[model samples]
Target: MRILRTDIQILRAIAVLSVLVFHFDLPGLQKGFLGVDIFFVISGYLMSRVIIDEMDAGRFSPAAFYFRRARRLLPAAMAMFAVVTAVVPFALTMGALHDYVQQLLGALAFGANLVLWAQSGYFDGQATLKPLLHTWSLALEEQYYFVLPLALALIGRRWRAAGLVGLLVASLLACQWWLRRDPSGAFYLLPTRAWELLLGSVCALPGLSARLPHREGRSSIGFDSGWLWLPIMAWCLLRGVDSVHPRTDALLVCLSTAGLILQPSAMLQSTRPWMRPLQWIGDVSYSLYLVHWPLIALAKNIWLQKVPDTVLWALLGLSFVLAQLSYQHVEQRYRNLPTPRALLRQMVWLLVPLLLAMGALALHMHMHNHSQAGGVAQGQQPVYGFDARCDQEGDFEPLPACMNTPRPHTMVWGDSYAMHLIPALQASPPDGGVIQATRSACGPSLDMARQSPQDPPDRGQRCIQFNRSVLAYLRQHPEIDVVVLSGRWQYYLDDPVVDARGRFIHPGQHEIAASFARVVQQLKAMHKRVVLVSPPVLLGPDVDLGLCGQRAAQGLLTVMRTLQTHCAFERSLWETRQAKVNAMLTDAGQLADIDMIALDAFNCDDRHCVTVMDGVPLYRDFGHFSQDGARLLGLRMKLGQKLRASAR
Candidate 1:
């Protein structure tokens, strides 16, 4: 609460540096994201202390509290947004700009986390292109600030601390549960992240603070001893958790930060000569955090054009200068201005209209371009276009092309991944000649009905009906030669069999395999050729592309590269799953007297799976390939060669 305790400032510097180095793609810093958790803990503690102090003094004002927060956070954020939005169009490709613009709007609306969560499910190489990607944390913090104060206000002081503690514990437990069950959701959403802030909040309790030894000149050894535990624990955490379990590791970082905060000693507080630079950076940290990522991204692009290290260094220096200017001229100016509550009131009054105008401008630009491109009519073939009569929720819907033409090829598909394969099919027609396509979240298997029973009742019914219709279409269209089915297989593999309360009732692994076998056997009886494309090897579930790009700019292996090399240990793990699924397919193939094309080996080699080849990113995120990567793989399939063959 003071002008940053020397220890706290040192930690802030460490937190920002860890993230920066991690962004720079330094080896062995995979857990750099833990830095954000540290920040959250710090924020929680500081904010709670401020609020409690003010309330105890009988001067707590929600409007004043919020005003300070806005003055501190919004101006710099808005400035960054405006600058990035203006520059991105000129620097990025139109397609990249379109996505960046959408993200920008989301960041402005304080919903960047939602935008990012939706984007996280798919693989998109362009994710790093958005400058505001880091704003998700700011958004999360803002969202927490809004709720924490109101909850305290409602409960009154007597019950507030207990209520806050209860909420923190509950949230942390929920986050841990979700981390194991659904790490992707846990990583992207705010609820799971609330615990880190809450951890700090717990540390801020007056009783806890009072318990600390505040006596000056006592032997600081005990306090300094806390630092030893922190790094050791931090090291263990960084080494232990991979992308699949980020939130789980986040807990460790939060705990480490809390420990460090609680114990402030001369040894820990003393700024080591080497650490001074880091502390200075930490002083300018907010600005450093803002500009570093974008500069790194731009540097990487420029470096690819053969810019030397000296030039890159110069660019970094330039970025630092700009950041200093922005902090001095923009952030400090706005943050230091005394709040005229009346002016604040007027700004709040204008906020909605201003935001609406921005949103309208963005929408107009998007629609204008879309209309120029002839919207959905000009070769924009919608395989799964909204049809009132069609079962939208169904696992499979026979495309109009397949329905009217009586195509000899039967394709099973869902979502963008399936759409990616279409170009490959058109380029190199399969042996069966005719091509049939179906796309939905629900795959071709009957298991879709069981796995997603939580879908809207109508949608669930429609999904089942759609699969039935596909089977009927197979029956009617006897010429359908080959059955090529593809969906995100990994998603189905780890399907949550238990509800949030931990009750288990859904189908297990054996049941899922049996259901899949049933579908394969039924299709085989129709004498259709079957090909099962295994899910592509992911970069990692927690692979932050923006972070990756930032790291790449720092002359380090991007997260993808690090995972590619480090994941040798994980191959055996992956191979076990692959073997189980392949064995199921093999048995089904044998039973049904059909050919089962195994494509798993095509994506991997003797040691590791290739995520990027020929300068093309293989994955859009953790699982699915980008369109470019998909197209390349598809071309290899058409040529009857494995990816390894072309690599050599």
Candidate 2:
């Protein structure tokens, strides 16, 4: 007989609720993300038990296992995707709509992890807008389900524990090693996460958890009470969240969850009225989890501003109602089908139409996008850089557009900050135009490479090599008499750096400032005039750069207050943040004859630094200028006349 464990239901409730709260940005449970870790452990334990028992019974079938999973997970998920697809054109921006289409396809293929891995940006702070972002976990779990059975079958029951143990150690060790280097890879991939599942697999190894004391087997009633604290304690320890992820905190949380799983149900299954609500929440947790994020994402997308706490409360209540309806209707309806054939027929009937509808919608949107962008030339990025492909991260050969009259006398160099300057440079065309030599993330440093949290261990070497390549280009091109340097200077100042000689380069303006000075001196030795463009103003993560201008332009009546959108900020705040960097730049300027451009001085006024001009957004994102923005700034700041004079 199948045992109906109320404890599993309760644990499910906690896991799903924590995830919901974390998504909603509720107070107190800051590390509610640990709930997903707990779920992984529980899922591994149950699946392992089923695979082992069925294999021993000689009835294990991959098709049957997959069909059962499909019946359990797919119906409500596809329905949500259908509705979200319908909502896409109305609520999201052009870029977001494009991303939505890509994500929708990834979700259908159960490859959201791979898509998101590729799309992972500089900061990864835009989680609220991506409605399907939570599906990465689902993708990882499905991949595990596909692989685990094969590995277990190969090893057989006799060596099950030994096999799981070996795999667990390998995965855990890899996770720890990669966390410091390629964080997103360690985070979103199956290999690193297999250990958490294997932990549960180890628990289900027949004789392992069987030796542990259960609630029903306990001598004293008080001993069973300690198990209750396990879940609570796990939630508390998860406060560090991803900072301590795939490490000790994760292990402890999984162990606590396993203990709760191993504990007998009799103590918690008592006819206690209070426990009914939690158990019910747990029963509907899967449905609730599927429905919550899209609701939150929809409000953020359409409103184009920060959602107030009051609206969030309403959304929370609405989420539960929607989840209950979905659970009662979609989840139960699909689950109650009499046979696999009946379930397959139901899946085809329900899924095919919705899938077709989403596909059609995506096609319409793609055609519309092509029409919108058809005016641009065939081989162009259309905005940030005239010929951005000339950069080190790109083709490394200057296109006609990247230079003036194809015989360039000026060189543009740095990181993405330099790319953002392309239009601004083009707007203020220098004498003989500009030749570009920029790299992404790899700043214009002589001997050291700046390291971000996302970079691999060898990223330092690659960056150093890229800088050397830039130097080689500069050496070969004696006609490039002027060099323009720009980058997100504060990023390099804030993050750690490594030198070409494999030495640790301390992160701060001191080392980077000195490095820039050396670069300037070397350029000056080549008789090239150097222009250093300082950091631009940033509105930080809280301000949605893409949405800020749109909201301001629409002049929407916000739920919070009249001036709800902050399209601009006080210059003082920016000045204060960049003081050290500005000081470093000043010191570097004194070392050689150079032109220093304070971007804030060009873009900001006495009171404010604005991101929008003439009702159009200048910035594509938080700090990178849109094409329109660069052009406007180029003209407004009189960059053309200034560059021409500076070249002389």
Estimated TM-score for each candidate: 0.64, 0.82
Candidate 1 lDDT: 0.57
Q: Highest TM-score: give the candidate number.
A: 2
Which residue pairs show backbone clashes in model 2?
Answer: 428-640
Worst 10 residues of 2 by lDDT: 373-382
lDDT of 2 by residue, 473-590 (tens): 7888898887888887766666777888656667566666778888888887877778887756775544555455543443432232221244666777766766777788887676
**Highest-scoring model, lDDT:** 2
lDDT of 2 at 563: 19
Q: Residue 355's C-alpha lDDT in candidate 1?
A: 59
lDDT of 1 by residue, 28-117 (tens): 776786777788998898888888778878998998888888777776666666565555533443334455666777877788887877
**Stretches of candidate 1 exceeding 4 Å from the true structure:** 1-3, 123-126, 180-182, 210-223, 236-238, 241-243, 271-273, 298-319, 341-417, 421-482, 485-524, 529-648
Please estimate how well model 2 matches the true structure, expressed as its whole-model Cα lDDT: 0.71
Worst 10 residues of 1 by lDDT: 373-382
